[model samples]
Target: MNTNNVLRQITYEIYKQRTVMPEKMRTNYRIERANGGLLCDLWFLTVGCIHDAQGGCVMCNYGKGSGVVHWDKILGELKKIVERLPWEFEDFLLTPSGSMLDEREVSKSMREDLCGILKGIRTKRFIIESRADTISEEGLDFVKKAVPDAEKYIEIGVESSNNWILKHCINKNTTYEMFQDAVQKIHQAGMYVTANIGLGYPFMSEKAAIINTVRSIKDVLNDGADSVVLFPYHIKKGTLLNVLSENGMYRCVSFWSLAEVLGYFSETELSKIQISWYKDYFGEEKSYICSSPGTCPNCERKVLKELDEYRETQNPEIIRRLREYPCSCHAEWKQQMDRENGQIDIKRTEEEYRKLAEIYKTDRQLLEQEIGIMKDEFMRRYGNE
Candidate 1:
């Protein structure tokens, strides 16, 4: 079906509508509990994700604010941020808007320069994020050398274990085998690996989303991941998810669904799971996020509080409490999950594809053909059920 070509065509059409702008980016940091101690989480801006230029993830808008790369300006700002930090931290996380290991995003010389600026920080564990394909032995070795004093951890966004969902749904362009290979490389380098699992993709039923996420979590854990991070769906501007939501074909994932997914694991597994982007953290700018996971106005605040507590404590009892917590929307969410029609609706999906074809001026016949193929494949896979 040439899914990449289709996704790229739509992505380029959306990109044409976007205006490039330069704004004063800020570095955000926060202290949180992890591994029985305080962990410092820090995020900085860079040239942005390289994949965004070629039809990136459906739910991501990380590359929107970025334009061209100015290494001097970015490194100078990072140095200023590092200078302001305290002498020591228990665990330090340095996250960039894009994959730090991608040379196109952050060149080798620039990485060395940034590492020079960060080498002085005393930390027990140093964590960074990268895409699975970019996680080479050289990159892992460089990070180990750059931060010799601390234990190294690389986080890769393995959004789903299902290759079909990874390609047709999220447009991630990564496979489960690629993720396993990356994890093995990291482990061979004597480092830790964390997998980031995403929930709430378009055209996926609530029950299917939860089930897929749970399976993904288990897959990564069994593949030697040291921890997992759960990222609930956030509708961001300038992405395919936003387009779907605007057209009434999508809705934000409910917080209860996240709680339900967490409940499937024991306290030991739960301890290794951390929820992020459910709500804003580090006082970062959220103007780009149209909506995030939530239940209702009545219980939103309390649910968020419990989620935050769970993030900090990793206590299974909190999830149990949330399961028992009363809310008017809970029943509705349960009903959606318990419904028999738990697969993607091929008819609605084809309609949306047709609408996209008209709006983006693509080939209507080709989209129809692709959708027909997808429908047949779905039936062949699930008809017996």
Candidate 2:
């Protein structure tokens, strides 16, 4: 979506209003105070370090096949960017990919050096991403020593608390115990944490899965994680989800349902949280599974409201056929074709998306072509074209 649009402004607006770290994870420094300087919170690094068997992103490929990304050339460029970037903000963030951050042993020195470079910057906030299993007292201790006084935010890829849900559904390796252990250690060292979670992974009953995901996030927040990154699933071509998309497997919950859940979060919980790219995946104003005022700060509920009005207009015609039916997401869901051709748009209403907090997908580009496609599609679908 055009960054200049009011809808797009949701992102910067959220960033602007977010005065403190989120509920799940937080830093010693107030995110609010530094909001103006966030433009300078540049992430300097190579994207080739991480690996996701399918690819770096859930939807696209970005690993071994993505050409060569040497650590030296990477670091050299990183140092240059760090130097060239205005030394304005108290600090900047270092966001590595699932593959880059997941690399071990041979990649250790590079990772350490990357941290060293960030520390040398003298920024007030320094963050890194790591799988739950990769964190340990030893490595964190080393990082602490190298970057003392900087509030370290270790992003734990604890996509879900349910092991079976994570392993069988998302193919993630880390377990809940591992997540707990990492959080414990980070807290012991007084470091901050941001646990990343996938709200509505496929194959699970939407209601059960969403409730479980929400509770788990609350559990971590209960543990005082500085922030929680709730990434809903997004369906795109070339993914298992994409394959299942035709079978209606990609749809999880509606943004409305997610909003209901967030609305129910305790007030003490509401003010403490912040969001990251709440709706960037679509590059436009679109509907995601999750869309509470706080949860999806980037989505302003305009297009979604349009979709809702479409459904409401179909209610009478839908009930004429279902007879015993009440107005609902399912009544509307079953009549999708009808909704499209003037039969009635009822099917769009009954998607029952509230079962999970939200559903959305993000992709990573391994080449100019792939990036262009995603970027273009995002812009086009959202009206940039």
The numbered model that scores best in lDDT is 1
Off by over 4 Å in 1: 1-3, 33-35, 65-67, 282-286, 376-385
TM-score of model number 1 = 0.92
Each prediction's TM-score versus the true structure: 0.92, 0.58
lDDT of 2 at 237: 35
| Tens-digit per-residue lDDT, 39-143, candidate 2 | 233332333333333222233221121223456765666676666654545535555433224555226677677666665566666666677767777767655
User: Backbone clashes per model, in order?
Assistant: 0, 33
Residue pairs with clashing backbones, model 1:
none
In model 1, what is the error at residue 60, expressed in angstroms? 0.3
Compared with the true structure, what per-residue lDDT tens digits does model 1 show for residues 27-64? 55677765556788776667677777667888887645
Q: Give candidate 2 regions above 4 Å deviation.
A: 1-51, 54-68, 99-106, 119-122, 145-147, 236-238, 281-385
Q: Highest TM-score: which candidate?
A: 1
How many residue pairs of model 1 clash at the backbone?
A: 0
